[model samples]
Target: MTEIGEVIELNRFDETSQVDDPDLARALARRKATFGASSVLFYDKPIHMASASGSWMQAADGTRYLDLYNNVPCIGHSHPAVAEAIGRQAAVLNTNTRYLVDIVHDYAERLLAEYPAGLDNVVLTCTGSESNDLALRMAEAFTGKRGVIVTDLAYHGNSASTTAISPGSRSDRSVPAHVRTVAPPEAFRSGDNDPGGSFAARVRGAIASLEAEGHGCAAIIVDTIFSSDGVYAGPPGLVDGAVAAVHEAGGLYIADEVQPGFARTGDAMWGFARHGAMPDMVTMGKPMGNGFPMSGVVSRPDVLTAFCEMHAGYFNTFGGNPLAAAAGLAVLDTIRSEGLLENARAAGKTMMEGLRAMQGSGSAIGDVRGAGCFLGVEISEPGSNRPDAAMARKVINGLKERGVLVGATGPHGNVLKIRPPLCFGEAEALVFFGAMEQVLAL
Candidate 1:
């Protein structure tokens, strides 16, 4: 029997013993044998992808599907500039950070230029998980406290420490002793009149609980978009008061920008800026190098200094490699030259309005909310606000059959996550909207 409120992978593939397609059948068997129980794929029937470009993925069968489930490849799949940069650099060098690579310094300067004044120092990593892991260590070392607070449904990373603090990632609704959870600023679900105040109150309570347990509230980290907690992205300054509360208790605030950074939020380069909150440390990845495995942590000099003074020999081999640096430089150049930030604002406006308009089709769409290229459509029962996980599954499968890719998220796995590449335009947005309407009609 499944545990109650067990956080699960939505639309996880359960291998079928038989299938009509011989190639797919063989592929499934191979995956089962190689990856074993750890293997997970999306959709009822997974597609064997061959290539992808400009918000669309083509399968081995030559079927092109509009991709709405991608968070990586934010600039669009296999972007020419990024791919070229990686290919060109790989021919020359692939050395790690210990080497004094010119391109690496160039990339670091350009990336750090995107952040605000206070967060100046940078520690490069191979993935956002690693960046967050380092941030946790820094917080613990600086404050001499082990306590952390995150959203009830947040998913920061898959590392041991990150997983412990990620309440929703657990098989059951259990968190580690030093971790506390606060409700996200759910403007749509809760209908709270004072969302900022309510979020602040929750943070205050979590801090008190941590202190009572002798953890002393080292830090309160959050995905500025609250991506895993149903994509709460409204009522600007929603997290401002909560951040103030954390600061009042002398806890650092770490902004996990893996979801909402790199101009994906439309209004600002980072999600925390839109929320009117400044973070002590910012962890970023996902779209940093467009498709390269590059991530980093931006923090104040003093905080990083404190941590380094204590633990002098921390290093990651492939963290700031030359190829990643070249790719990062290319991604930065592409974003500016292609006008993606403005495109995100325009295309996102189209998507949000189109989705909100689609709500009139049926009561199954309980809510449509989010910012820029990242949005969530909450599925619910026809006559009530109760989440409809079954209907969500049906809708996701239906969209797949119609050559549109989307996924479900949230605590109940009923919130349809719509995060396409930043290059997605009006044409792509309309494609998804039309396909969604067709699915709902079915």
Candidate 2:
């Protein structure tokens, strides 16, 4: 038998650092041996884990690292309140959606109340991919159209239909069709002095192209905060014009809020609110169940009714199970009771301002953009706006070495995505900012 230990060198982690586990690699090897290797693996480097609590994750080597990458842990990892709720529900009941359940109704009512009065229809799912797939279905059923328009690098979900609408699908070695992609408002890549203006122009061009192709589109799916495409929360009302164009072309507006919803933006419960636009369909996930596998789509009642009338039966095995509902309810309750949204607003202000201030002092810091807690710091070459993915990776990896865990975003992976749990405090931001400054200095 091949010795697994000789294939990799193990690194020791500090008490507050992430630990690596050989077991994870062994498991990966087992998968490779049986099911073949993953075609979409980003890197070979893997961080194995033991457990997570609050804002820290422990690895096999007993290292505890501060977490800044996990947007799903909105109430914070292993939050006692949410855990207790899940445990209670699991012990009592875990029924399917076919049975009448109060938890589902209560969760739907509470979640719906957050949106504008007319967008009240809701459908629960197990992942963001499912939510987006449902949104696509609604668009097709309501408009009897098969075409979709998506942002150039927008990431909706990994399901077949959602993948058809995602640019990441291509990078993941998947082919897509029947989708029109528009350039998002990116100041760095578009070479326009005004990213917002450039974005609008690109959108107009996409609409024109789609119209010419006889695929005018049933809907244009947009990530309200554009998380995967480098986190550009556009200038207020910038996307509104594009949305108007789509509407005029007889298409619905779909907002994929999987990464930026549920008060992650600080000012609003949903990222669409920040864009100053009302979406025809809004898909959400990640923070909805506080790390539990639950997501949903909120649509105009008429659109959902159309889907219902056309589809015969749309059933998901564990879409809105009792346990998932309990988790969702707990997440909402914790967000309200803890004032986490307010916390996100205050802490996010500190993070954005601090990053902007850092930009003034260092040429390595290119641009800082986003709203509330959904911010991204773009690393670039000195005296140029060009993305410096290498330096960005160094920064992120260095922070991880120093016991702080963050993530990289953008098409080139040069943007530092700072979406920690909504419960993250200003003090924690200061710590992260300080750590960032130190890493950059190094």
Global CA lDDT of candidate 1, please? 0.87
Q: Using Cα atoms with residue i matched to residue i, what is each candidate's TM-score against the true structure?
A: 0.97, 0.90
Which 10 residues in a row give candidate 1 its minimum summed lDDT? 1-10
lDDT tens string, model 1, 15-50?
753467988888888988999999888888888899
The lDDT, on a scale of 0 to 1, for candidate 2 is: 0.78
What are the candidates' C-alpha RMSDs?
1.6, 5.8
Name the runs in model 2 displaced over 4 angstroms: 1-36, 39-45, 172-177, 188-194
lDDT of candidate 2 over 1-442, digit per residue (tens): 1111211111112223332556766755564577653422222245667899877889776878788888989889999988999999999889789989898889889889889988988888899999999889889898877788877667788787877887654644233456777767776656666776666677777777767777666888888888877888867775787788778878899988888888988988888887766899998888888889998989898999999999985778899888899999998898899998898888788888888777754567888888777788888887787778778777877888777887777777778888888878767787788888898888
> Which residue runs does candidate 1 get wrong by more than 4 Å?
1-7
Model 2 residue-pair collision total: 1
On lDDT, the leading prediction is 1
